[model samples]
Target: MPLYQNREFTTLMTLKNSRLRIFLASCILLLGACASNDELDSQANAAEQQIYSEAQKYLRSKNYDMAIKALQQLESRYPFGKYAEQAQLEIIYAHYGAYEPEAAIEAANRFIRLHPQHPSIDYAFYMKGLAAYSGNSNIFSRFLPTSESSRDTKHIEEAFTEFAQLLARFPESEYGADARARMVHLRNLLARHEIDVANYYFRRGAYLAAVNRGRYVIENYQGSTAMADALAVMAHGYLLLDMPELAQTSIDTLKVNYPDHPSLSDSGEFDVAQVDEADQSWINKVSLGLFDPPQPPQFNYEP
Candidate 1:
């Protein structure tokens, strides 16, 4: 329309065109960088394949050391490629299958640290626990410590800890089911140990001490087969301390809870009337002022 309006319109069009050109140039530069990265990736993939192939052959031949070296080389060459993850798992297996327990665990741990979000992270944890399990030896019993060679149970516990962590963190993992089955056995052993300590205190003359120890078994190991015996021992201990109320309470619990409960009497199982008859004899012979059994014999052998 007007000359000034035309100039302004031309200026706006030019600015728009410049902005569009700048955006197009940035896109071209981005594409060029992507192409360069792809080319490098292609070269890396080829080298990774070579290293992986060699490592796999070594591993298959049971040459763990050589396999480890080749896998390590692959890691150094292409640290972030698909082959890198495969190499990492192979390294763990190499150390594990070769009986290098500590190295296997370390390799598995390293894989986890580096690839925390990996879909196969559960496998890494399971492998670490397996390494721990392989290291554990149950050769020595707690008794005969001097003669028996003691096997370190640390690895067993560590294995269990790692397995439990896997189950807890990745419950849906395939390994979680097996982890639970092993835990059942470990927990039972611990429960039995507590019962043994309780029985030890009960055999001594420490009634209060026995009561406390028995309580541990009852509270902590409710379903253990030893629980009924523990409750019975606790009741006996309470009776010794002249606390008939607690004793009766414990007895009631024992009878209600344990269908096959132990005998309440410590000496032996007998009828209530027989128990009273035995008590009567005990009172007659021991307590003199109130009532005493008559002296039976006084014979003179003098001429």
Candidate 2:
């Protein structure tokens, strides 16, 4: 009884030990597999970072097209990597630098929609406005004395609205100051454009239309440099339209606001045409400097 029982117990203990060894080996193999996968992931991350760095170099060198390609590759290859979101942001910058304004605007809008809470979202907004602003610039106006503001007020108004949104939403953004400055210039441009339209009406003998344009300048652009000219236009236009009291009121206001204006006569009456004619001499006419040029039918307002 004692011999059989001892042999059976020894066999059972040996089998249990054999099973434990197999279990430990399986655990070790599983851990090794996990470690290999982790290492591969790390290597992949480093490669992604290197690609992102190369893209940054392209951006620094102002090779926007190359940068865009590299960034696109990095994003596609490592969509969930550490640099994926950053690559997206840099793509927008690259589009902007490449003078692809529509693309830049589209990218910026995509970023804003996808990453609304991103810390650098204000930059996207700023870029959007800047792209719109540059897109509206006329090359001819850069050299000509034409007013940019008066040319195409539509794009200018859209850009101003974008900037306004940026300023309103991110008052403390790095771009806020610049946006504000642009907004001021836009306001003046719009005002001057309106006044130019008023002058056109005056020259065409549309007195009431001219007066309405001047009133638009006064109401919509209160602090513009064109206010003095607007008052002159209103006074002259009212007088032409047989509105004596309104003309007198505009004349009085113009005198109070701009006593030394060139459009005013010695008696403080609105007399722009007289002043214009007086300044136009033979030499001045030939030289084209005798007086300010008349407002063209299609004038631009340069900011």
Candidate 3:
């Protein structure tokens, strides 16, 4: 135990103590960093929850525009948050509530693509179909004397297809029953639209075109109410085309199915005399029914 040996031992002890202090300080700094991260995460989650709550409140209040804004903010801020998917789903409803059908459809489509396995996927599809169905109507049509069956049926057909897909994929969905009911209405509308087109062609002396349209309705929309009108069109067109046997077949079928159809006489026969009398004069045909007008044949039942 000399003085130099004692001093060396003391220096070694001091160095060891300094190194231990540095190690402990590093550990403390790391722990503080982790705690800060946890706090920040908690704050972020709280903010996300707050935004989601506000969105829900807006939705419950039927303030769709504000709900959409809040939902969009939540999604943009925390795309991977717990409420992100729910926010996306609610955005579709918000747009629909705002009467923005195309936007709702697009949002629903986006949700379907992004979260294909989401539990609410069926809801997305249902909303998409509903949006398309709503898109077929407008404020004007509600007030004005408009014939929806006479307008372009592209949107209506799209809605029908959308609902069909929903039923095919999610047969037990809660929305299935309503979707089915809407589909029946849409199918009838489509059939009537085809019959209206046939009637148009028949009025313009396009008997062959009218017959083709009627045949299309019969082949595609068999169980529809338009079947009787389709048969009448086919019968009248066949008579005009000099196919007496085909005309007779259609007339007989119409007689059995729709005996009280307008084109039928009191004796339960197709009124050939009325159809023959409906032929337009040359002047009327040239004028497109504008001048020298003649009563055109109407194969559709008015009742």
TM-score of each: 0.49, 0.73, 0.76
What is the Å distance of residue 121 in model 3 from its true position?
1.4
Candidate 3 lDDT over 1-303, as tens digits, reads 799999999999999999999999999999999999999998998898899889989988989899999999999999998888888888988888777889989999999999999776888888887778668777565446555666778888888899899999999987788778777767777877777777688789899998898899899988876777778889999998999999999999989988877778999878855542322110011112211111111132122
The digit string of per-residue lDDT tens for model 1 on 180-282 reads: 7555544443444444554456557677887886688688766654566566667777877899899878777866775444343454331222322321221
Q: What C-alpha lDDT does candidate 3 achieve relative to the native structure? A: 0.79
Ranking by TM-score: 3, 2, 1
User: Which digits, one per residue and each the tens of the lDDT, describe model 2 over residues 1-303?
Assistant: 699999999999999999999999999999999999999988997898789889978987989899999989998999887777777777888887777778878988988998899888887887777677656654454346644644777767877888899999999987788778777777777777777677677678888998999899899888877777778778878888888899899989988988877777778767857533321210111123311111101112222
Q: Which stretches in model 1 have alpha-carbon errors above 4 Å?
A: 1-47, 57-66, 138-153, 192-218, 221-303
TM-score computed on alpha carbons, candidate 2: 0.73
Model 3, position 262: C-alpha lDDT score? 74
Report backbone clashes per prediction: 0, 10, 0
- The best candidate in terms of lDDT: 3
Off-target runs (Cα >4 Å) in candidate 2 are 1-32, 138-146, 242-245, 265-269, 274-303
Looking at model 2, residue 144 earns an lDDT score of 68
Instruction: Tell me how far the alpha carbon of residue 103 in candidate 3 is from the true structure, in angstroms, after superposition.
Output: 3.0
For model 2, give the RMSD to the true fold: 10.2
Residue pairs clashing, model 1: none
Q: What TM-score would you give candidate 1 relative to the actual structure?
A: 0.49
Best by TM-score: 3
The residue pairs in collision within model 3 are none
